[model samples]
Target: MTETLVVDASIAVKWVVEEEGTPLALGLRHGRRFAAPELLIVECANILWKKVQRGEVSREEAKMAASLLERSDIELFGMRGLLAKATVLATDIGHPAYDCMYVCLAMSRNCRFVTADERLVRVLHQKAPREIANLCVTLEQLSAGSD
Candidate 1:
């Protein structure tokens, strides 16, 4: 069976940048189904913008990266129905609603939400402690599975 996962912008950015977890994120793109909330595109773009501002990447490079991501096959789901659940989860976990949107989608789809956010990972394990906790997986965990 194939693996399907909800990935956040943290992971998405790694696809374009040669960051610490880039290899694991790249490994995830190999024959795996990736899904994200429509917000991911904006989040990714914002990340690229920051990189450009910090002079880590050129404006042209950021544009090229954004274009590549937009053209990628990652299925984008609308945020219409996910807002309420995300809000509730965010309040419950003391995390931002934006991050919870991906969690909600992962729960709704019954697949892991893979992320590179260490703080979110810590919160999920420490505070979530139940269904929400179960829905999230760190990049390390997913990468470890292939070994």
Candidate 2:
């Protein structure tokens, strides 16, 4: 059976938007089960908004990206129960609470949180490697089969 992976917005955004490492993120979808907090759509939309504002993608392209993302097969999980733990993780890791929602979900699922957020991966390895190194894997690392 394919292992379930927790994906954050950084990785999910790459799925619908053309970006560096997008191929890696797209490839990760094949034969793998992806799970994310319910806020994934909201985060993705915000990213698309930013892209539009920066003139990186037209409004129509952003809409298409949103439509594609909405149709994707990722399993969504609620973030309510994750709040306290996510907050603790955010505080402990010096990362934002919103991002911690993904990490906390990964912890509960006992799976790797695959992300394209290099800074999050670096921070996790730097601040709490022993505790979280196994919990998070960068998209590049996963694509290289190093995770």
Candidate 3:
């Protein structure tokens, strides 16, 4: 069976930006069936908005980025039941509630959680990589077939 990948906004954001591991993010998008918590849309839009405000991206670029994200084939997991699981995950991982949502979804779905947030990965790795199991991977790692 094909592996399912749960993508976080940090990794998804690289799909549009010319970042270091953008190719890896894009490759994953094309190579696997992707899923994410519904909060991903909000997070992605907020990131684009923040980039626009910071002058890192133009208004038009932000719109395009938003559209691109909407058009991707990723399946969005609903927030139902996820909140409680996320809360527990947050406490266990010492990550913020919102960040833990991605981890929770990945665990619930039995899929890998792919991210571009190095700090989050480090925390998961340091605290209890086995707790998260084989469910966490960085965009660079995913691109390199480490996922």
Candidate 4:
């Protein structure tokens, strides 16, 4: 199997929608496998819904993005089995469980967890147990060889 990296909704959203760090975010896709909690899909849908509401994208464009994401090569893991662990990590790190799921996945696989949420990074730096904190990285950090 290709070497794997864990990605969260924040990073995945940029794959379909142009935004800051988008180029770097797209770079992470090259020759590497990505894994994430199945909640990734719902999170992407929720983002698209918000984009449509804010007029950032057309309804048709949002649908197209959603379709493309569904067919993307990302590997999705069911969140049910992950819930309790994720919840504990979230509580321990003072971050949302949704974001913690990506970190947990990365920890399990011994790979980097890439996300666009710098707030999560700050929180991890401030509160995440060192082991898990070391697993979280921003898209730019991973892309620029700084991770």
Candidate 5:
């Protein structure tokens, strides 16, 4: 069976940016299923915008990135059903509620929330409930799994 991962913007951005884990994140595309809240679109767009602002990516590259993401096979979950749980989780973890939405969705779907945000991982590793911690895996962990 294919593993379903709930990826946040950090992981998603790697798909377009030639970062350290870009290949690993790309590896997931073939045999795994990816999911995230609709919030991912906005978060990814903002990241792309920032990259453009920093001159790390040209406007044309950002547009291409956005187009590619729009065509990617990621399953997007709506925020309505996730809001309440996400809010409570955010409060509990002291992380932003936006990020918690991905965690909440992963919990609801009984899947892992894969992220590249080290601070978020560390915070959850130190303070989140064991259940929540168990639902998250870093990009490095996911990469190691293929070997």
Candidate 6:
């Protein structure tokens, strides 16, 4: 099976912005298929909204970013079973339920969990009693080898 990656909104946001980690996140598209819960759409929208509010992007730019995300090839997971698993993962990991949702989906689907949230990485490393079998890589890690 082609490798799958569970991408959180923090990293996805970099796909649109030419930030420090943008290239790393964008490079992920080359080797693996990307997946996320439908919640991703809302989360991404919220990021764009914040950028708009901060005057970093114009309203039109925000709309364009939303459109790009909607049209991306990343798969969206919405099954009830997946959500239940996510809830359990949230409890086990002691992270926000929403954050754990991505981790759960990745584990369930045998995929990597990709994010740009440094705090999440630290917490996962500290709290997950056992090593998570799948990769949980940050955008920096993804782009590291190239540079």
TM-score of each predicted structure versus truth = 0.95, 0.95, 0.91, 0.94, 0.94, 0.88
In candidate 3 the C-alpha lDDT for residue 102 amounts to 88
Output the TM-score of candidate 3.
Answer: 0.91
- In candidate 3, which residue ranges exceed 4 Å CA deviation? 129-131
Task: Estimate, for each residue in 1-147, the C-alpha lDDT of model 6 and write its tens digit.
Answer: 677788989878878766677777778788678899888988999999999999998999888888988888889988466777667666877778888778777777777787888788767777764445235766676567521
lDDT of 1: 0.89
What C-alpha lDDT values do all the predictions have?
0.89, 0.89, 0.84, 0.86, 0.88, 0.78
Compared with the true structure, the alpha-carbon lDDT of candidate 3 equals: 0.84
Could you tally the backbone clashes for each prediction? 0, 0, 0, 0, 0, 0
lDDT of 4 by residue, 1-147 (tens): 667888888888899889788889888888899999898999999999999999999999999999999998899988777788889988887677888888877887788888888889879878978887888787777787876
Tens digit of per-residue lDDT, candidate 5, span 1-147:
998999998888889877678998887777889999999999999999999999999999999999988988899999999999989988988889998999999999999988888788778878899898888878887778721
- Which is better, 1 or 3, measured by TM-score? 1
Clashes of 3: 0
How many backbone collisions does model 4 have? 0
Cα error, candidate 6, residue 7 (Å)? 0.5
- What's the distance in Å from true for residue 88, model 6? 3.3
Give lDDT: candidate 5, residue 84. 98
**Model 4, 116: alpha-carbon shift in Å?**
0.4
Tens digits of per-residue lDDT for model 3, 17-70:
666777767787664798999999999999999999999999999999899989
- The whole-model C-alpha lDDT of candidate 2 against the native structure comes to 0.89
lDDT of 2 at 140: 87
